[model samples]
Target: MVAPMSVWPWGNLGAFKYLLFGPFLAQVLYSRMGEDTAKSSWCLHLLIIWGLRLFIHLLLGSFGNMLFLNQTRRIIKQGVDFKQIDREWDWDNFLILQAFVAFMAYYIFPSLADLPLWNTRGLITVLVLHIGASEPLYYWVHRCFHGKYLFTNYHSLHHESAVPQPVTAGHATFLEHLILTAIAGIPILGSNWLGHGSLSLVCGYLVVFDVLRCLGHCNVEFIPYRIFERLPFLRYLIYTPTYHSLHHTDLDTNFCLFMPLFDAVGNTLNSKSWQLQKELNSGCGNYRRDIPDFVFLAHVVDLSSSMHAPFVFRSLASLPYATRLFLLPFLPIPFVVMLAMWAWAKTFVISFYNLRGRLHQTWAVPRFGFQYFLPFAAAGINKQIEEAILDADKLGVKVISLAALNKNEALNGGGTMFVNKHPDLKVCVVHGNTLTAAVILDDVPKDVTEVFLTGATSKLGRAIALYLCRRRVRVLMLTLSTERFEKIKKEAPADCQNYLVQVTKYQAARTCKTWIVGKWITPREQSWAPPGTHFHQFVVPPILSFRRDCTYGDLAAMRLPHDVQGLGSCEYTMDRGVVHACHAGGVVHLLEGWTHHEVGAIDVDRIDLVWNAALKHGFKSVSAPRTTSSSKSNFIS
Candidate 1:
């Protein structure tokens, strides 16, 4: 029963495939020992196989200097600009030992003595079975390697190469290498147990498998896009070069080898594949390099009492309506008068390091007291914002976020005026209000049906109110003016989704389960609420808080966990465990791909993105939840 020429279908494609496979002697074993007995020692035979693999791999690395075999060699030379080509040799030092272990652990006997009766049907069946079985099995195994323990000790060594080369494909701990080799044998073992074994086909399959593995990791793409662009469906059948490269960069995505079927099934496909592939092909890593690595924006506030003017503004803002009106002439200069006093605060360049010890810096610009209370500040603030953009441009900021009054002034336009004004400049200005709203909403309890909100006329308050109404949640809009209160009530119905929204003005001596400190509420105004209720605080200059406080405060998304305290060391302090929401928005823009992405106004869709990113990075309230404890941190009654 002589196996026909088609029995070793891949064997005859000799010259180049044999050079690439390197185990030429194995090919000879198949040819000469068709029906012969094994006389030579099996140990020497196995050693020769491993030695040939290493030799062939080194041959490819060396020949990369001499000639081009596919586009892979040329790509390795230009793609990542890897300075140390010799580094692979360092990783290669372990190969012979790994190969010996692999042989001893699995391929011990003279399996070559019984080359199966190979047929075309068995070849196709086994190839398909190997691919199908390996996809899920390897997907699971690969995910397991990402576990914190295994990744730190074993699998992480391979991930050191952000830009992988061919040699890196085999670079792994002995355990990982063993696991890979063992899984490759599963299909063959199953076929043998089913009485349909074919060792000859297994040999060809291994050769193809190795070639594809190296090709994927080679850092060069030879697969013509025309094949997929024209046929489209063909992409699902085979993994592309970019597919594996994405897996190396993003840990949770692109988990499958050989085919992406399991990756798609598990919903782990890299969402940025197209954008990243284009960049990779252009010799850029997965992220943008066009802009400065870090950028931060700030809105300046006028100071009267300490840098935190909340104390000063509270006294003037909280006087009884008649008393405040009689004293209107003495009220802190109107925004117009203050606008004349505006000057760009000294721009501070902060140099710092992250938890990972990566050095980063930010440029902060202060706007002089432009919050809404200043009245005519909006129009004046726009011009100052222009000046801030110009200053930020001099330092080459890639992304900038508007804070506080600046965000409020630009809420509707969302810095579009600034963006449109500086069309020629290379700076991206964002309102960042979307993320502000997101973190605030994250602190609210999911089951709550009624929410008491202040600052009913302001953008932050309105955004929160509308958001609640759309979800059929009732909100009590605490307004000071009867005129403004009625206006809001009139517009509430049309603004809500299918649900009819309920909104009401706050009166004296009221109590509620949940209160949202939505506006730039003074410390005195905050006391008006029942001290027994739960509070979601969004004010930048938070009211002072102490242990065993009367009311509990919910703070969300603190960048510097060390900043949390019962009494803030800076100008103002938050209730213990409370964080500022706007801080997370700034960080999200910096770490996310530098797309010059500006989150303007309230895009519910973009808000979800920042919210997910904040949670993924563990940026949440780090203090104890509320209870009816009493303390003297900064009680104001």
Candidate 2:
């Protein structure tokens, strides 16, 4: 018969201390505890502290629903929808089960707790070894559970709540929870059995560590990164709020527990995704990745040939109506220019290349225009031409070559025209017909950066653009005709301008590239505002700089300065005492101190000015008032 271990007479007192007094003592000790003293007393002290912390959290957790409900109500009233605040009792049950399993596995399993390995000296060594061993062990086991077979059956439940709530931490199948707990606990038990430490020390370490784990999973935002991340060694040793938040947001990243170092080393950390989520949560405008190719392709196929198609159906649906009106007219311009240039490049540029047979020569044109396309269309195209020309002074070869046939046909047209326009533009335009341009590209001055073709279709231009992208040449495709420009803009990829370079017939490609690189063109130049009015007045502080009494043209010319951080949306408001300009999202009041003056509820002239200002600030379309939905009202109320 197994001998039953009797509870200590002071066990209840110890429990009380563990659940209450210990944490308070730990807080006090945190300030005064010397490094050696802290390390020496870690097991005894942490056992008491963690016991108390865990008990307090569990005690408070009984009312966790009420707390969440209150928070939900507050958030709803603050404009966030109630539906967005996920309230699921299922998650609570899951978290409880996970905790229960972890406790049972750590405390109950005799093979682990009674291991002969951990009967050694010192609490700090035991704690560190336990933690170091637990992480890698847990990682591998967790990864195995994510395997196709196990994932479908057990792991899927945990993943159901991608935007994990506080209650989501422990939500898993009982079996899955048991498996995970065992995976975490078995290593510590094995470490102890290996003669590394004592069971008492292990228990104390487990208690404190588990309490911190629960606190980390809790949605309490009291301990922010700004405070905790500033700490010297603590930043690296312990998990911070931001670390777990990223795990919840992006399931694939930040898999390591306790510290991010392992995840960083393993290349599983996603800092960018985490940063993006933080920005979104802070009410910085909705940030989404540029539309995926398949989605963009769907839009193009569905809305092709319709003028309203580009305006009515696009990722720009989020823009204000005024902004839409201002920007929509220009949407078709890039497409049309792209198409015409494609035609010109195929007909003339490739033909010139084929006729010359001197495909090795480099061409130079102004740095701007469909340079992004050169990589894919032409094999052996020099990649360095695009990189070296970061500024006018650093500009390299002025001429580039075009392949006869390649994948993206769109480039064959516009790209050709863009290259041909440069005075020193060289062409290696190839022709299958045996009839080609007599110009040997090498014979042309090395100053040629642009190339033109009269035969390529939009398809060919796309090929050239893709080719240039591979070679890293920033080729610009230009069109002389407005109609054609619109077609090309509509047909071209969203990143085409950045890569392929699109220009109107009127603008000099070389001059345009120079201006763009130099940032010389003012917002008024780029914007569709009326001439003469200064857009500079609208250019306000860090968020937006707007010119006062600026015409649409003036607003257009006002490019966002390079130094501005976190640029989102620019807004113009003509409300109250003076024409007020503000950025959208954050609350900015006019008065120095509190005076009951709402900027939105100003004079009618101010309202008109605000509308004009929004237009000047580049709002695409304003949202029309909708009949208040019951759901929306409930959420807001």
Candidate 3:
């Protein structure tokens, strides 16, 4: 069998007083039954007044309780943590006792005796004094409660509800509540004795103050700071929902009732509270500081010292108006010095070595001078390299190639080959992949003259062309196939195409020659030849011969007579545009005249030697046609 819990009738007596007597007294007072009463009659009149106030407060409290209960039910149904709704009414009796004692001491005692301190003038003085004195007293005593000695004994009960509910406002040890109430009453007693005021005034002040205190500690957000803080006078002195809510949550600072000035002046304000408020208002997650050290200091400081002494002292003697006026003229000197230092540092102090390292490691080196033999490949290779070379070339424009050349060997045996072979041809190569294009382009030097494309159409090539075109870069296409060449030309926007054409024309005029290589002929297929022995030639100056078996090296090896110097010069000039010509014995022929006459022949070996020499001279290798293995086998056979 389970044991039965003992019942205490007194436990429910306070609740009974609230429910039964509250409404009856409210009706009597609201009807103004004791407005013209003497001091002797005032006690009975106040009983009616307090009863009415309590009645209305309980009515609201009941409604609030119903709302909270409904919310709790909903929360439970939604599977919210039950501990969030944890409630304990253990301190209700103590709070009731405190309220009873305050009512007797402040409202009831003098009513019975018409004491000089109980008059209207005395009450007014007490109300005014209470406003000024109660706050500082509460602040110091509250600070003491938080001290090491009192916290564990008296203050811990209040802190038991870390997330305080409305009922938890006055929940504390009986002695603790009595001590605080007595401290709060000191101002009223002292002020009444100093300048006696009215009972109505005193009662009104207590009623309003208690209401505010209770509402401030209420769990429900009735008085939103957003609305209340906007009021002019209320914004200054009265505490808002936020102010008191922070006191409960923070358990420090905001100890004063009427204003925050005391906290600010005392330097005991919880800096974290201000930071939290800022973060909450700004919707920023940037609160860095946690606990404020001053809160602990506030706890140790003696209450007498804190309450009696002014928190902040103002003294004009520290720095007179004359001193300020004297210093005003020199302000510009510091400003001028700072400005000059900033300008100098910005212009000359910063080091380029770090930038150079970043460029070398992360950014692709700009290809400035062209080398025909080496090719570079990487992400955004075409665009980055082209931009870099163009930015680097000032005197003459340089073009970039879509070729793979290792960074380590690029200067000696890579993209530099094109510049070395054709000293007059300015070009460079930038290496990158799709991921690196943006970085490479961003860091590309400003001297590159042009960007050139080789091989098939690729994203990198298109990106490079697009980037250069956007930056008003001179972009040139040097591929072997008319299919891709025409596609690129057509795909390019009208403005970009026009720009590219203008750049090409300008480059051609400057070099005095332009070569259109590979499959980009007027009638595309006209250049395509069948496999096997066939004559390949071009029409040029009369100095060179169009032969099926002639090479450039054979022409050089011929050591033509001195009288034929004009023919050699003509041949050299024609070779600039003549990209390739195949001969019957694997030779390259230099065709001459308007009809491409066979005037001279060069063997394959001689052609190879000349190409090798050009390679040695730094001429990048042009992409050759990939012949089928069957065709090569048949040629060998």
Error of 2 at 444 (Å): 94
Task: State which candidate has the highest lDDT.
Answer: 1
lDDT of 2 by residue, 540-623 (tens): 111122334332211111121122221111111211111111211001111111122121111212223333333443332221
Q: List the residue pairs that clash in candidate 1.
A: 300-367, 301-369, 302-369, 555-579
Q: Best to worst by lDDT, what's the order?
A: 1, 3, 2
Candidate 2: lDDT over CA atoms?
A: 0.34
| Cα RMSD, each candidate | 23.9, 25.3, 33.4
Tell me the lDDT of candidate 1: 0.53
lDDT of 3 by residue, 1-637 (tens): 2112112224445335345335434544554564533432443545654554444343333333332122221111111011222223333443345435644664544533343434556655665566577777777777788888677766775776544434455456656666666765665556555655445544665566556665555433444335434554444466544466677667767776656656765676655533344344443453221111000000001111111111110011111111223334655643454345323311110000011111100112222222212355233333343344444344232222222232223233323433344444332232212212222233233555554332224433444455556567675654445565566566656777654432222223223111222112232222222222121112111112222232211111011111111010011111211211111111111111011111111111233343333333332332222221110000000
Better of 1 and 3 by lDDT: 1
Residue 267 local lDDT, model 2? 84
Candidate 1, backbone clash total: 4
Model 3: what TM-score? 0.33
> Candidate 3 — worst ten consecutive residues by lDDT sum?
291-300
Q: Which 10 consecutive residues of model 2 have the lowest summed lDDT?
A: 292-301
What lDDT score goes with residue 623 in model 3?
28
